[model samples]
Target: MIRTESLTKRFGPVVAVDSVSLHVREGDRYGFLGPNGSGKTTLVRMLLGLVYPTSGTIEVMGRRMPARAAEVLPEVGSLIEGPAAYPYLSGRRNLSLIDAIGSRDKRSARRARIENVLGQVGLAGVDERPVKAYSLGMRQRLGLAAALLREPRLLILDEPTNGLDPQGIREIRDLLTELNKAGTTVFLSSHLLSEVEQLCTRVGVVDRGKLVLEEELTALRAPTGRILVESPDADKITGILNGRLVSRAGEHIVVEHEDAAELNAWLVGEGMRIASITPERRSLEEVVLAATGPGADRLDR
Candidate 1:
């Protein structure tokens, strides 16, 4: 649903976003990942046409960006940096005002739509308390409700779970998953590897303003010709596969093998009682760290 080719943005002499190409297909829960100041926000802004790129092109839903933002943005929902609201106004009032802008929906249905999104984001019980009285998590939920107000075909979220507790985070995750399953394409940008690992189908890693790696989550997490085994007869197995054994810690062992099933069958055939055997795969954390450098927030001497 979104595509960018060598898209770049420069602030004076600093290139906040270098030549980066991004692809987010329809119905994809694509995770755009990078550490602080790695150009994730900058790139997201460029995609939404909020920040003009220094060069290159952006296309959303088959239409060129900035030029076609008016035509295309209506179908795209985004939460960038963080959400904003009139602090003195109640959340409901704030939403009512936002829902009226450039919205073609019938006025009669506006209240129901607002209430539906508020409930979706876990703010259904929110009172008439002004936004200044709401907690950080509440504000985050308000932002999400605003994004869902229109039920856009594409969602672009940045640090979507920034201020929530675990339960809130899980709720939002489930909501996004449900939306994606129902055919809303999601482009999620965040520094949280675990969250992305659990929610995203595909991932792109950016480092120092450059796109470094792009791959399907399954492909990136493929088994690496190794097996983890837990057996009561650990010593016996170790002795039999001494050359192939990578490590042994009591009953748990790591073996260098290409096929886990064959090894399991061979062990069973040899009358070695087995407890468990499974192929070892790289975690998402390892893959992302290898692709990106230290975050910009880190200082080195």
Candidate 2:
């Protein structure tokens, strides 16, 4: 439950965020994607009231942001950059400290909550270890546990998968899925398209400080007809198809088309015997780049 209207932010002469609008429905796992310096973090900070917008309106969980940030923020948990923890403190101690800051119910209850989240993040038995000794993945999990200490209705995560190995990433991904399934709204900002493609129900793409695309992840990843044909006379088939040949794997040819059946029929009508034909679907990354155009190359910076 988040909404923004004409959200704009500036740093003197440079506008970091420009007239952007976004919406996330309740219980939605929404991904906010943009390249470096595209203002994704700036927009997230504005939503959290950590930074004030130059001009715009923000409503989070039905409460207007900035004006009621104090009241509204209590219902939200966020990790803006990386995990913040006391290096000298044990992981359990770090969580206990956060619980105290959030005014959790009681010492025992807070400890229990911390343990529960730590376990959820796959750090069950390592709580006694000092944070300084923990790996980057462990620290990330610890940060997630701290964020969940408050049991907020909304979770804002920035690059939660950063520094995580494949196993750690899967664990965090599963945790987020469970949270969303339990009705906690997630607004995740990430540079990893693969992570977003796997976790988000919907996505918003930004580039050059502008909102360029927004859509349901399923729609964006819808299957498209792609055919891989292998024949002795690949050149003859390519000429008959009148379509651009994408690539060749040995004697096979990959061609993208809107209708596979039509292409097959055309080939058969031309008296060409097809050895094999396999269909393929476009991926989320491909669709995103297509929608945003060639400018996607600019996102790396």
Candidate 3:
């Protein structure tokens, strides 16, 4: 649904996006990730033609950008930065203005379409409230409602859950999942790693204005025989397990060759005290940090 080739953006001495190539397939709940100043927003701006690329190409829905921006934007929905609304306007009025921007009129078909989206984003109960009165989470929902006004084929969201509480965040997460399940392609950027771990199928990690790693979530989470053994005598435990494939990682002994049962039996038989034994998975945060930290360019999927 989206593709970029050697895409770069520059501001004199600094490059905001650098030769980043990415592919977001149809129906993919794609997660774009990086810390502040990593150029995720700049990259998305270039894709939306809000900023022109320094070099290279961007394609959305098979149409090249900057050239076909007008033709293509209608089919793409985006919520960048944050929700913007006329503070004096009521929530319903806010949506009516968005409806005016597009040629399609959902007015006749929807209980005004405004109501449908308000309900979709869980704002129907307060649809008549003034924009100034809505909470930040409510405003975020309003932004999503505006994006959905035209029933777009592709949704581009940056920080979709920015102001949401736990429940609101879960609601948005479930909404995105349902939208993807119903055939809408979702491309979202977020600083929330746990959210991405639960919601996204594919991930792109960017750093220092460069794309460092792009991989399926399943592939990025490598399976391992690394079981964690935590005890006060972790050092002594590692010495005992050294005959097997074992290594010390902080206060834990990571046993590679022995299963939990074998390791526990050996520990008890050797008269060593044991605290807990558990299998460990390399977390997505670790993978992301390794990819986007110093020397990020050296990493790959």
Candidate 4:
């Protein structure tokens, strides 16, 4: 439930965010993607009211941002930049301190929230350990716990899995997916393409401070298969399947078709012995690069 109209932001002569429009529907696990210095975080900051936009409008959860921040942001949980926790304080104590700043403003319920978030982020038993003794992954989980302490309707996470191991990444991915399934609108900005490919249902791609593409991940990843079949009787098979998109490459016939089963069966019906059939489909990363062109760099931040 976020919409922007030609949203622009500038730092003196430098424009961090250009005229960009974006839409994120309710219940969408949306991925906000762009290469390094592409203004992804700048846009999110404007949406969160951490910074004011130079021009344009922003509506989040049906409320104009900054102007309605008090009404809209109370319902939102965000982890921008990174997690901050006192090194001397225990995880439980650190969360308790962070919970004090929650939108609910219920200092009386802080203890219960501390425990609830510690458990939610997989730090229930070890929450008493000092933050200084915690691993990087543990600190990341603590940051997430801080974000969830409010139990807001919207979650805005920028690089939620930054500096995490493979297992830690998967853990965070599963947690975000579970949260989205349970009705929390998730807006994630990540450098990991594979993570976005696996976790997001919709994606908005940005480049040069401009919004390039916004669409369902399913539509972007639709099945457009290239079937390559090898056989000793390649000539006969090519002749039978000859079309504008069908061609014979060496001893193999390559057909641009969706159904590999039907294509394979067509060749087998002619009493042709088939060696093997392979279906090649363009992946989400491929589609993204195709759309973004060469401006797409290694976004492994």
The candidate scoring highest on TM-score is 1
What candidate 2 gets wrong by more than 4 Å, as runs, is 102-104, 224-226, 229-249, 256-280, 291-301
- Tens-digit per-residue lDDT, 123-239, candidate 3: 888847689998899999999999988888999999989899999999999999998998899999999999999999999999988899999998888556677787787777767
Segments of candidate 3 deviating more than 4 angstroms: 104-106, 229-242, 245-253, 258-278, 294-301
Return the clash pairs for model 2, or none: none
Give each model's whole-structure lDDT: 0.92, 0.85, 0.87, 0.85
Tens-digit per-residue lDDT, 1-301, candidate 4: 9999999999999888999999999999999988777899999999999999999999999999999998998789888878888998898888776666634656667888778888887788884667889887788888888889878789999998887889889988998899898899999999899999999999999887889899999888776678878899887776666573466777877778878888778768879888998776667778777767454355552
Q: List the residue pairs that clash in candidate 1.
A: none
What TM-score would each prediction reach against the true structure?
0.96, 0.86, 0.86, 0.86
TM-score, cand. 3 vs. native:
0.86
Q: Considering lDDT, where higher is better, how would the candidates rank from best to worst?
A: 1, 3, 2, 4
Residue-by-residue lDDT tens digits, candidate 2, 1-301: 9999999999999999999999889989999987677889999999999999999899998989999998998789898889999999999998887788748387788878888988988888884668999888888888888888788899999999888999889989999999989889999999789989899999998887889888898887665656778887787877765656787766798887766678778788888877877676667777767755445346563
Model 4 lowest lDDT segment of ten: 292-301
Task: Please give the TM-score that candidate 2 achieves against the real structure.
Answer: 0.86
Clashes of each: 0, 0, 0, 0
Q: Cα RMSD to native, each candidate? A: 1.3, 3.3, 4.4, 3.5
Q: Judged by lDDT against the true structure, how good is candidate 4?
A: 0.85
**Candidate 1 worst ten-residue window by lDDT:** 292-301
Candidate 1 lDDT for residue 118: 93
